[model samples]
Target: MSTPHCLRSSWHAAPANGGRRENGRVNDFDPTAYLPDDLLERIRERAPRHDRENTFPEADLDELRDAGYLAILVPAELGGAGLGLAEASALQQRLAGAAPATALAINMHLVWTGVAKVLSDRGVDALRFVQEGAVAGDVFGFGISEAGNDLVLFGSGTDAAPQADGGYAFTGTKIFTSLAPVWTQLGLHGLDTTSPDGPKMVYAFVPRSEESAGRIVTRDDWDTLGMRGTQSRTTELHCAVAPPERVARRIDPGPNPDPLVFGIFSVFELLLASVYTGIARRALDLAVAAAAKRTSKRTGKPYSQDPDIRWRIAGMALAYDALPPQLDALARDVDGLADHGTRWFSLLSGMKHRAVTAAKTIVDDAVLVAGGSSYFASNELGRLYRDVLAGLFHPSDPESAHSTVATAWLGPLED
Candidate 1:
């Protein structure tokens, strides 16, 4: 497959580096730049339409894909820049700050791609799925959360079994599959339901053409107050699993997961933290901007100067400043872990819990500052509010995650 000429010449994914334009012309990327200001401005412009129309941020995703943002964490050996989890998490934070739903919806690709990159180290074909999607400009989203199964490690899940012919089929129902509407491939997680105790690996690759996975389904009436654009819906699967190459089983820490996986996961959590924080930051930014421009009815001054507003702003700022260092600490711990699991799992759980709470508090402050305007659908604060609220629901719900943490610290939830 030939690479696009536009990508070669007249295009730059980030202004940090001058690159060839889409017309196949070479340019120098500036080392000082992080993201092109034009790109940020463009995302902000599109955010309103996406928030109002309750539509997927197709334009933002397209730009992200074209700029190779989807492949940032992919290893250089596998045709990716090979950024670690810290960088990946920070990028997510920036994206979330601009548009919460858009950022959350797109992150499924990052998580799955990162997982695939790990699996790909075993062989090129194992990870070919990831590279193919990035090159094709298609972002793979997860349909992983099954209410029926209720297994805490993930959302709803079922199982896939190897067929008589050595291929497999996925037969399970999944719920809360955010971004299922636009996903090119489904990172459908399931237990090997065929197993008596469901003790086998069952990640299936189900194409979108399956009739059951029709463009959208509202079964179980999953209506989230926030993240309405996610269209996080439920679906039943009776699809054939394409056998490309055998992937590894994801075991619990007792079996001692690879340090690389543990390390990467530590980074992944921080990324999640950053993403929600970004939503909070954007909410605060909008609220402050709104407050600054509003004239008080009683005084001829900007309402942003009001004492209560100042307090809220201060709270938001504190959250903004505090989360990064916490995340960075976690990243360093994971990076330096000579022994994975049973050694660092407790600390990882603690950081995960702390980060999630800190981010939620930040969003709460931003919402408080915005007042009625934050509730208005026309306002960016409202959209950020919804996105941040939805953030609380995934990567393991707060309650279950809390239980997991306790079990790790004190030993055994069942006990």
Candidate 2:
């Protein structure tokens, strides 16, 4: 599939900007060089099948692992591509353009590695094992979201009780646990109210092993409206334990300035934005292609020549063009350790909000531009329309993003 003209101009313009210096030389990074068109086409071909079956994309994962896509954020010395968040964002956009479910599922793994990269770059080695594990081909799953847990990262519904061995045993349920079947390690957080220091948020990693037997129960209930290949099942933890070495952090509950908090927030929000932006890019391309091919019954000419079709496509392009630069700039800031202080939360959430809303708008317009044929489930635009809705459910949702930005500007409602 050809990329939309507007996207190709900005997306691939920075080919050498996000690579790491290796052996006293900098490696030039181009997302297509890593993803390649053929690999993406294969993933795309499997996407509809996985979505139809509502099953996890196992083949897609194997192919991605073979392509070294799992370790994109790991250092080259650790046998990875040694790319930064900027590069990772670009790669995700490309991958999502082909297979959103595959890209979204993989985004969870990338989030852990991205967080590790963010923290390690700032001299904190608490998550160095994550980077090494990624290079060693161990998939890390994100186990954070909980039903009705609005505190999200600031607090948790799960319990993290301290053990005598300096470990912590987590007991609770984690919803939307992506990579449910394949993750070798799960990164999660829980509340530890029994600690001497009062209620603290405990961040840790639990490996999938005999120790986790009967402790971790993955419920086979991932039926969803779209992005079915993610298989983000609900995980029930019955005293799942994280060894001392796996306990990465402990911070006070409800909004803390800890580096781990910043790292998680930055990587998660930016990566989520990248994925949705990719959906928008794909929708825009489909609309453009549809317009050029379909003839207008009234005018006896291609829809692309119709003023109304042109206007709609132009609006989609205008919205789509704003996201790449924003993603690149914020991702580069994180990589460069450019601190925005408390403003970082607002900025990250706002970007995510804009990307998701714009994606939905673009997809809605694309559906209109593609005409009646796109209404069928078999059409790619139809699939994209459903897939794009998942964006509204991700972190920094419309309500949260608005509240965050409001507080950032209006000073917390005089509370």
Candidate 3:
């Protein structure tokens, strides 16, 4: 499908800042080289429009696809950049700075690709097809989050009824499904209590095709307080079938030690943290710029000279600087196969929780530094204030992270 007319205009209107490559390939495996300042500026220009219109950043997606971003984690042998999680996390942080919603929506796709990369690095070839599919321009969406299933990946309310052919039919509603309008495959999990294995959780990819007629429905109800451009809508799966070939993994439910689970949690939480960290970085930058530009009546000088503004900006910077290095270290650990064991979960969840909380706090301080002008809905800081709230709603929430940490420190509560 072609990009919308509004996005097309914005694309053409953007100055030719030499961001596009002459060969149309991003093989360097470096985000700094791939996502240049000019490209980010173009994306930043389109972000407000998408947010205001409550639509997906189709233009940004088109540009990113052209630049081979979708296949960043795919192996170089598979015609991709062959970058690792550390690099991917850095790239996500940069992307989020330009447009948080766009970066977030695309995070769903990257999660699958990152997991495939993680598994492949660990000598698991199960998800090789995911890398291949992404190289072939197939967009993957995450469909694991379900309403009222606070158990997270430990349990599923969706039914995974086994088929005679060894596949399974999934019937359940998936909430907050990002890239609903354009996803070609959805990675989801459901419980199969009737299975001979005695209650297995089936993780599979359901293809979008004519065969899914009336079986898959994407709702048009994504109006929200912020991150409106994500267009994460509710998806109804009425007996959505996953052929045997698409079935990725099947394991006993309820927190068994599974690599698939670890892959998902680690990549999801780290990448999610990366995005919010980027948002915080952007908020800090904006606050700095605003303070340097706005003159104060009392001092007849830039607010940046004011001790209060300087202190707030310094605080924001201090909070922001700590995240990227932490993200880098953990991502490197995953890439290096450093065995953290169960502590990996606590570390991942804690990093995500801290990143989101810090990002929100930084944005709040940013708006204060930006003054009353940022209170307007059109102001980027105002929009960021809203977007940061969505961080609290993601998995491994504040309560969950704290519980995990507490359990790690003191062990699980008495039965």
Best-matching candidate per lDDT: 2
Off by over 4 Å in 3: 1-29
Query: How many pairs of residues collide in model 3?
Result: 0
lDDT of each: 0.57, 0.87, 0.86
Give the per-residue lDDT digits (tens) of candidate 1, residues 1-415.
0001011111101222332112111144231133456776787788777666666677777777767787876656656656555556666777777666667777777777756543343232344666666656666766556664444333225656666655556667777676766676676655554545545555556556555344333354445666655566676666546354423344331222332233234444555666776776676677688778877778777878888778878877776787766665555433222233342444554555566667677766766766676777777766665666665555545665566566555766362
Superposed by TM-score, candidate 3 places the C-alpha of residue 404 at a distance from the truth, in angstroms, of 0.3
lDDT of 3 at 161: 91
The numbered model that scores best in TM-score is: 2
Per-prediction backbone clash count:
17, 0, 0
Write one digit per residue (lDDT tens) for candidate 2, span 1-415: 0000111112112213444342111256666778989999999999999988999989989989988999999888778878888888988999999999889999999999999887767667789899999988999999999998888888899999999999999999999999999999999999999978978899999999987999999999999989899999999999999999999999887766677877787899889899999999999999999999999889899999999999999999999999999998899888876656556778889999999999999999999999999989989988998999999888878888888777777766653
Full ranking by lDDT: 2, 3, 1
Using TM-score as the measure, name the better of candidate 1 and candidate 3: 3
lDDT of 1 at 126: 46
The TM-score between candidate 3 and the true structure equals 0.92
Weakest 10 consecutive residues of candidate 3 by summed lDDT: 1-10
lDDT (C-alpha) at residue 128 in model 1: 62
Q: Summarize candidate 3's per-residue lDDT along 1-415 as a digit string, tens digits.
A: 0000011111112123423112112256556676878888999999999999999998888888888899988888898877778888999999999999999998999999999876766666789889999999999999999988887787889999999998989999999999988899999999999976769989999999999979999999999999998899999999999999899999887765666777788899999999999999999999999999999998899999999999999999999999999998898877766676546778889999999999999999999999999999889999899999999999888888888878767777797
